[model samples]
Target chain A: MPAVIADGLVKSFGDTEALRGVSFEIERASVLCVLGPNGAGKTTAVRILTTLLRPDAGRAVVDGIDVVADPRGARARIGLTGQYAAVDERLTGFENLQLVGRLFHMRTAQARSRARELLERFSLTDAGDRAVKGYSGGMRRRLDIAMSLIADPSVLFLDEPTTGLDPRSRLQMWDVIDGLVADGTTLLLTTQYLDEAERLADDIVVIDNGSVIARGTATQLKSASGGDRVEVTVSDRDDVDRVPVVLAGSLQAGVEPVLDHAARQATLPMSSTDHVVPRVVRSLDEAGIDVVDVVVRRPTLDDVFLQLTGHRAENDTDADDDDSTSAAVPEGAAR
Target chain B: MTATATPTRSGPVPSDRHVVPTGATWLARDTWTEATRHLTATRRNPELLVFATIQPIMFVVLFVYVFGGAIQIPGFASYEQFVVPGIFAQTIVFGSAFTGIGIAEDMSKGFIDRLRSLPMYPSAVLLGRTFSDLLRNIFTFFIMLIVGLFVGFRLEGGLVDAALATLLLLAFAYAFSWIQALIGLSVKSVETANSAGFMWMFPLTFISSAFVDPSTMPGWLQPVAEHNPFTIVTNATRALYNGYDPGMDVVWSLVWAAGITVVFAALSFRKFTSNSK
Candidate 1:
């Protein structure tokens, strides 16, 4: 059986329908990332799955227990880390974890030992005894995740786990999430970052305006959107205008390239990049248009989102490089 | 940090669905856990404890000397004898406002979401909050009592009467904590909770017989003061402290405490469970 299943979940707050018939399933010991922009019902969906909010009309089951029918039973099997780090600012990190352990009904000695182990695992041993108010944002978030894992829950939910972290801290958080999945724990993660979904999710569900717009693996989604692309940057700003015409003349088709006038760059969406680059470069050289750089690039998740939704995924700020001309990142064994 | 530390999930799971206690045992355990969390936080922040004590001491001092001679009660010899008990009642009631403020802060910080997602008893958050605030009220009560004695106030009743009065005051304040918990959950921000929690309390304490006799108030406001619940509690405590028979006021005060606690605790828990935000 699937470890987690959300079926026809519909929730509304007064006049606003936050989620409308959203559904997904996560296989055991695999990660599913619910990708969306702000106000796209990502949090509402997560809240419903974690049993924090009851769905108005639908059902969610975690580890074979119905969330709506038996929330406490579902709660026992799942742990949640919300968008904000929910650690008590006034309590020490160790105290925070230990307190959650006690609430889970662990013995005092067992709670203490588990707290110590989690603190060490999260690289928070030194800061365990100090109040969380003094810790950095990353430390607080790590402790927050640790609190949720106190009982070694079979299913864990991290809602926008690294939404507002520095790039360095975000990388660190990704590594920690990778380690958890390595232990064969079923994970359901929600994030707005497309790269985050690409990096961690075994399967991706993209939602917008409270509905699932697309769902598949990263490669499948990218391929569905389009194929490879060729980007050319000219040395002179004036050369940008003539480059697209030259490319159409060389490729022997009516090719129209998207141009960035300020950057003197033109990008053409192509079905195949094989042998297209040399033809374009030779054409540009014959046309005497001073070329700065030319390269072929794979379609990114950003392109997929733009094609699916007709708008770029919210802020795609960090994924900006991947959209403009970046080589495919090497796949790591960790995630 | 090394990501290679094999995750703890490799070990046997320690606790799960079957281990969770049910009914009263579950409620008591989770309430105490939450209470301990609040109390430990209070202990670590000495300034919070210090400020909680300071306000009551200030009220005791200000009322005893500044308004002591000017205001007089019909049955009391000195205003110190009457106003000291009133101050105690007022201080504890005022202390209850923190229950709302703390809950509002927790809600804003998303700590309530964390607790709600847990498998623990649903009402424990409210119970724990009020319980810890009640403990703080007790501590503040003693400080005000000491400060009252230092300023020439004396208790004429037996030790048991005095203890009973203290319990009544604490019980009444505990009920108010539930009301504050509801307000805290209703308000959007800590700033709003701070003002909303104490906005009606000032009039509730003053319009009653807290600092003076109801007979001394304007004729139009006398009846409001006479029937006010705060007045009943203050009258019960004041009579017991001054060695007078508390009469039906004691019974009525206990009734009010029990009624308010039952009604508001239920309301607060319902609000807590259904509060989507």
Candidate 2:
């Protein structure tokens, strides 16, 4: 059975319709990344799937059990790491994990043993005895993940777990997540970070304005956005208008170039970036078009996002740049 | 159905056998776990325990020492003796607000989300909070008694009545806790939780028979104070503690306790179920 399935999930928070008939699934032991911008119902979808939300007009089945019908059943087989670290600042890392263990009804000895095991796995053994207030952001996040993993859940729901971490910390968290996936746990993660979706997601579902707009593998999505292509910025700024006509004419009988006048660049949609470059260059020479620079670019998920949603993801990477630029950033910005 | 699709790699067959007890057993365990967690924090945060202790003592000193000389009870030997029940009523009433603050803190801090995602128990968080605060109230009652004894507060109703008074106060506090829990769950923010938690306290406690005999109040406010639950408990506790006519106060105290507990517990549970989800 599939680990998770959400169909036409709908939810509203007062006047805001947070999830508008959104749907997706995670196959057992594979990652399904719910990729979206902030406030795009990513968390809402995870919340519904994790049984923390009851969708207004949809269904969620986890491990073959309907979530709304049996939230306790769904919860038993799933682990969730919310946007916040959720670690008790006053409690030691070990104590935090131990508390979760006991909350899960593990015996005291079993809880302690599991706490130590998770502490070791998360590389927090030394810091385990220290209050979580003393932990670095990454350490706290690790503890949060460890707490989620205490029950060894079959399906894991991580709702933007690394959304506020520094790059190094983000990577460390990614490593921990990678380890869990490697151990054969299915993961349903939500993120606004395109790279995070690309890096770890086996399949991606792009959600926007409380709906799923696109779903596919990363490669499929990038190509669907418009595949690998050559971008030519003409040497003479005025020649930009003529370049597309010249190139579309010489390259193929049916090809068309999408031109950006402001940038003075014409982007040729090509089957392969490198394979078509030589032929395009020969045609450009024949047409006597002098180019300032011609480079083949592989479309990133951001490109897919722009194609699907018609806007850039106001994301972690750009926000991180602004944050490190000025120390006035009181806390890490959310992705 | 997005989830009904094929599995790429099915997880191992029941890799971790869940032998977890369900129903009441799981709930009791979960509640106990949360109670211990709160108790641990109470122990580690010496400042909080000290503050919890000092605030009530300060109230006792202020009311008995500063305000005592002017205030008189016709049938009482001393103001301090008459004020002990009032102090008990006020202490536990205010202490009940901590339930709301704690619930709100858990929500803002995301601990409620963590607990919700687990399968062990549904009412565990609420019950655990009430349980822990009850323990603290018990502690506060003991402290207030020790300090009351020093200030010449006597128990003329004898030991059995005193023990019964303590139990009534605890029950009253437990009932009030559910009211706070509802506020906390509704507010769901640490800042708002505090204001919302204590918002009803001033009007509820100040207008009651806790501090003074409701007969001394102006006619307009006297009825409200007399019928108020805070006044009911305080009156009952005073009767039970000072060897007075235990009468309707005892019946009304338990009735109010049972009524508030059942009503607010149901209301809070309903809100908590939907809100947490």
Candidate 3:
């Protein structure tokens, strides 16, 4: 049976329809990632399902409890972590968790022991006694997630859990989420990062303007839209021609090799990169092509989204790039 | 802190570890939990605790010394004795504004949303807030008493009467505090809540017989002051603490307290449980 089911959920704020007939379901113990840009009803859907906001129209059930009819009952079976870290800044991390446990109706001793155990599990034991305001963003996020688990909720809704974090912290949070999946917790996450959804989700639901646009496994979505492309960076600008030439014969039929002189790079589009990659590298080495880098660039979520939405995933970003331009991320993440 | 408990797919929930007590048990437990959070915050921020005592002490000293020489009352022994109950009323009304400001701040901080998402009692937030503020008031009342003693303010009645007066004062303050909770929940910003709280409270306290007998006021304001709840409370408190005439005003004061609590607590609880804000 599905752990979560939302049929025809609808909500509005004044004139703005935040959600319009939104619907989806998630199997037990599996991860379903809700993908959408900011203000695309991702948070609204999560809020409705977690019993924080009541929908104007629809029926939602979690762990067999109706969200509309019995929100308090549904709340008992679900844990929610919002985009913002919702833990109190004035209280110590341990105090925050202890209060939540007590609110969950645990005995004093049980609450304390559970608080201690969670702090340790989240690697917050050393800093648990310190006020949450003094914690780093990553530590606060971890604590926020830890607080949600105090009652062992059957379903967890994490809305943009790693947003605004440095890449390193994002990786750390991902590892923690991965562990939750391993423990068989049904996870429902919402994020704008296609890579995050692709990496973490068992299934992905794409929503835009309060409606589901597409839904599928990450690999299937990628294959249905476009296949992988191989990126090769030649050390010498003059050898860029040899780069594509050596890769041409190994490429599949109907697939063409493209060369970029400015960046001294070559790209080959293919149905699959597994067999063609080794052949291209061997042929390049045989030709003394002097390659700086060789990477299999699977069609990014950006491409799949463009294929589906008829526009790039980001509203302001351009669609075209050198077939395999590396994501030009800044050196260090500021937030 | 995402992990509350590991999800168990099938079975009766563990009675000892994960039982979610409902109704009154849930309310009492959650209110106590939230109250402890507020108390812990106060301990972590000693400045707030110090200010709670210092503000009341300052009020008692300033009124008894600087203003005492200028004011006179016909029947009382001294102006300090006459104004002590008055000042107590003003201090508590002022303290009640914290209820509004605290809720506004919590709403702005997204803390209320988190609490609402939980399986806890709906009105526990307001109860916890009042609980903590009540504790703060009790502590400050003692500080004011010590300061009152040092400034020629005497206890002219029995010890039990003094205790009863304190409880009565707190009861009125708690009722007033619920109105502030309503204001706080209705406002958007904490700044607006704080400013609006004091703006309305100032007239209610000052227009009453808190610092001066209503008889000394202008003809029109005198009648208004005579019937004001603050005037009623101060008169009841003065009678209980100073061995004065125990008129129907004491009964009226309790009625006012109960009336304010029932109307405002119901309104505040309704606003709190609604989906708005």
Candidate 4:
């Protein structure tokens, strides 16, 4: 049986349908990354699977227990780390972990030992005695994850674990997550960063507007989005307008190349870039366009978003509010 | 799926060690653990405790020194003896507002979300908070009691009566904390919770018999003051503290405390458990 299953989960907040028939499964001891832009129902889906919110339709099963029918049993098997660092600022790091351990029904001695172990595991042993209010943002996040792992839950859910971390802290967080993956823990991670999904996820589930638009390995997703692309950067600004026309003639009769006028570049999707690169460059040169560079590359997840939804997957680093209830703005809607 | 799938190791899993205590023991342990979380936080932030006591201390000093001579009750010799118990009831009841503020703060910070996801009973969070607030109230009550005595207030009642009176006031405060919990869960932000919590309290505490005799109020407002739960509790505690017969006030005050507790606990628990909506 799968370690986690979210089958046709549907939830609505009044007039807003936050999730519309979302479904996925995670095999035991593997990671599944739910990737989406802001307000794409990633948090809503995670909440449902974690038994935080009851779905209006369908069901979720975690570690062989039905989440709705036996939420307590499911709760005993899973742990959650939310978007915000949910540690009590007044409590020390060790105290925070100890409190969580006790709440998880660990005996006092067991709780204390587990607290010490987790504090050291997170490299917070020296600062374990100090209040969390004095800790850095990175320290708080590590402690938050430590608190979740206190009971050693079979399944762990991290909701945008590095959403607000600095670049260095985010890398550190990635290393921490890497260690968890090494421990063979079943993880369901939600993230807006495509690279995070690529780096950490065993399988990536791409959600948009409350639906799974695509799902697979990173390479599978890139291939499914479209094969390779021939990108040309022209030297002159005026040459940008003519680069696409030449590429269209050489590639196909009516295929339109994606244009970036300001960057002086145009990208055209092609199934095979081997035979077409030189011909495309020759065509552009004949059209009197000064080609600065020509490169062949596979599509990024950003390109996959554009292919599937007609817009780039926007990572809202500026948005500080929890995204579970963010408005379900349509793809490509103005920010 | 990625290429880094680790070979499933053979070992004892963490879930195997989980032996959840059944029924009442589980509830008791969970509630105590949750309460300990808040109490430890309170101990760490002594400045918060000091500030919490400061307001009640000021109220005791202000009423006794600034407004004491101007106000008089018919039966009592000095206003300090009559008003001190009222302040006790008022200060503790006012302290119940922290219950709402704390709940709202936890909710805003997503700590409530963390608790909800845990395996413990849902009641533990609310019970733990109110329990910690009760302890904090007891601490504040002692400070006020000391300050009240310093300002010429005396406990003329026997030790048993004084302790019972103190228990009744704390019970009423604990009951009020449930109502505050409901308010805290209803508000969207901590700022809103703070204002919503204290807005109606000023009238609830002042329009009653906390400072002066209810009979001295305007004719129309007199019945409202006389019937306020704060008045009943104040009247009960004051009678016991001043060595007077409490008549049926003690029974009535207990009834109010029990009734508010049963009704508001039901409401607050429902609000807290179903708060995902």
Give the alpha carbon lDDT tens digit for every residue of A45-94 in model 2: 88888888888999899988898988887787788999999988878999
- Top candidate (lDDT): 1
What DockQ do you compute for every candidate structure?
0.43, 0.32, 0.34, 0.42
Best by TM-score, which number?
1
Per-residue error (Å), model 2, residue B103:
0.6
Candidate 3's clash total is: 22
Docking class of 2: acceptable
Ten residues in a row with the worst lDDT in model 3 chain B? B5-14
Q: Which 10 successive residues of model 4 chain A have the least lDDT summed?
A: A324-333
Candidate 4 chain B has its poorest 10 consecutive residues by lDDT at: B1-10
- Of the candidates numbered 1 and 3, which has the greater TM-score value? 1
Per-residue C-alpha lDDT of model 1 across residues A1-335, encoded as one tens digit per residue: 99999999899999999989999999999999998877889999999988888899888999899988888888877899999999999999999999988777676667888899999999999999999999998999899999999888878999999878877788899999999999887898998766788889999998887899999997787667665667788999998888877766433233235688777888776656668878888889999998889877655545666779877655444544444433332221112
TM-score of chain A of each: 0.87, 0.80, 0.84, 0.83
What is the DockQ score of candidate 2, to 2 decimals?
A: 0.32
Candidate 2 regions exceeding 4 Å error are A12-17, A228-271, A275-301, A309-335, B1-16
TM-scores, one per candidate: 0.91, 0.86, 0.86, 0.89
User: How well is each residue in B23-54 modelled by candidate 4, as lDDT tens digits?
Assistant: 87778778888888888888878777876788
- Of 1 and 4, the candidate ahead on TM-score is 1
* Model 3 lDDT tens row, B134-228: 88788778888888889988889878888888888999989989999999999999999989899978889899988988998999999999889
How does candidate 3 score on lDDT?
0.82
Which stretch of 10 consecutive residues in model 2 chain A shows the poorest summed lDDT? A323-332
Candidate 3 chain A lDDT trough over 10 residues, lowest sum: A326-335
